[model samples]
Target: MKRLLAVLATATLLVQLGTTSASAAKPVRSSAIQWMGHSWWPRSVGGAPGPSGLWSPANATVDAEGRVHLRITRDRKGRLVQGELDTMDNGWGYGTYRWEVASDLTAMHPEVVLGLFTYGADPAYGHREIDIEASGWGRTPITWDYTTWANGHNPVSRTPVVPGRSTHQFEWAPDRITWTSWDATGALLATRTVAGADVPVPYDESIGMNLWVCGCTSEWRKTPATEVVIDRFSFTPAG
Candidate 1:
């Protein structure tokens, strides 16, 4: 009888252990990266195939469900260039969404392309783009603009982000129709009122590239290739 009780107790313990392990494996907020395949890799514009500068795949990776993983890194000369193509129907077509970039902006260049979305009227309904162009200057901030063939404009906002040491978070809550930014310390840097009226949703919009580049004013620098380091990128439903 004692041996029987011992066996029963051991079985119960094993069952409890299994339950606990399963519970611990539940999907966490940060780890919820969907696998996005090669469909999103960037394509060059000209005959050379790619932008005027040079770009290549990094330590970044992708998964099965079409979620992408990337680590943005600088080159030997403290420069980097990387971008991905828009392969899926991003939230811009319709619906509310949020995007987050956990970035370390040190003594880098004076320019960055955090994210972009195309907005314009065309049979293509495609070539339009919204840009979050940032310069390394704090008080000068960065710029956000939406452009199209028929109608387009550039609007600048003062972000006052400190370079050399900072992790920043940028968010867009379309339901609220506003954009917000916060520092690593959770301090609000700037807030801009965005409206469906002001920035109309592109009917078939998509997320293209958690991208960054060196030139904000011109094409690539004097060099043929430049690169930047990206730690990771994530997108979630924005309230």
Candidate 2:
């Protein structure tokens, strides 16, 4: 009888251990925290940036001064981790999406692509993505690129990004998307409007901001860590 009782106790402990293990593997959820009047959630993903990359929630934070800061860091496992945030809710459409960037764009890491734009899951409704990226493509002379993509067509406009704090904007309207950027002293750096078939209808896309390694070249396989700060992000509805 004693041997049977011991076996039952062991079975009960095994079940409890299984329950604890399942709970520990669950994903973390953040819904109460809001930044810049928008609910943003950080990603914890792998299998990106050529071969592999990680997005750590700790690498994305908002300061007491109300600035959004994104960084690339290393995890406890010695793997490279970066910051990427997306709005929790979708359908921010047909308006002016603007941000004030505090990072100096003249000097940036060669493999880094600082992206601020909209993304959609479905390819049929919207174009799936629009990007305002600051990248050097793993080389010198980092510049800002306004890219519009739809139906396998991708068009990009490159422009110089100045030093100090600057403002960037993309106004999505009925049939066009106008992109603009300014220098620290309120001087316009770039402006262009993209229309025609490549323009998306702003159907079901959400805002996203990420500081990630560029997969455009072989540089994504290297080790690099950096950060970018944004003063604010605002949206003005179309009139």
Candidate 3:
């Protein structure tokens, strides 16, 4: 009887260790950003005009390596989902913003948009905004746009992005804004410059990034589970 009891205790210890090991092997989910937030916008609630899709923190994650992963998938109700992050500071001014696309964006559906932009008010208020968007725009894949709001001015570019990492940057100055995209090899893919009257000046807005479906419908985004990884993001204020 004593030997049997000892063996049972040993088995219980082994089981506990196994459970602990399994838990440790699992990847840890990150905490939400303090200054950044996300939202879920349904199709009925003025969806197509803005970041026009559903968003949840569960669809965004920062791994131990500090890479931000924005995922798009279908929910249990068959609704298309996406992810967004917006800075809490609404006092963003003239500066340089840069982001590295760590995933193969070419693999994503044409309707999938990876946007780096700034937003203030609605367009009716002559809202000042700038965008570096990668999307199919209801066409083929690997299309990009550098746009300025308030005037519907956008320079479209069709550049084949390599299936890896790349860089996108914009410099917002008081007189002009420059947008550039670079391939993984550090080669320039496309660029757009807007100056003179087209430059959006003296506007304060929050800088944001999102991975969303264009029309919140499968007609644009055929893939159910899509993701965009951002390796790094930085902002430099003007001196």
Model 3: CA > 4 A from native: 1-46, 49-52, 122-126, 156-158, 216-218
What local lDDT score does residue 96 receive in model 1, on the 0 to 100 scale?
A: 31
- Per-residue lDDT of 86 in model 2: 68
Tens digits of per-residue lDDT for model 1 on 138-193? 22244332232212343535455443323333344433234555555766666665
* Model 1, position 73: C-alpha lDDT score: 47
* TM-score against native, each model: 0.52, 0.83, 0.74
Ranking by TM-score: 2, 3, 1
Question: Global lDDT for candidate 1?
Answer: 0.37
TM-score of 2: 0.83
Local distance difference test, per candidate?
0.37, 0.70, 0.62
RMSD to the native, candidate 2? Answer: 11.9
Best by lDDT: 2
Cα error, residue 120 of model 3, in Å, equals 1.3
Over 4 Å off in model 2, which ranges? 1-28, 125-127, 216-219
lDDT per residue for candidate 3 within 69-180, as digits (tens), equals: 7878777887777776655345467888888888887766766777877765323213466788887755566666777764555453446666778899888888788888
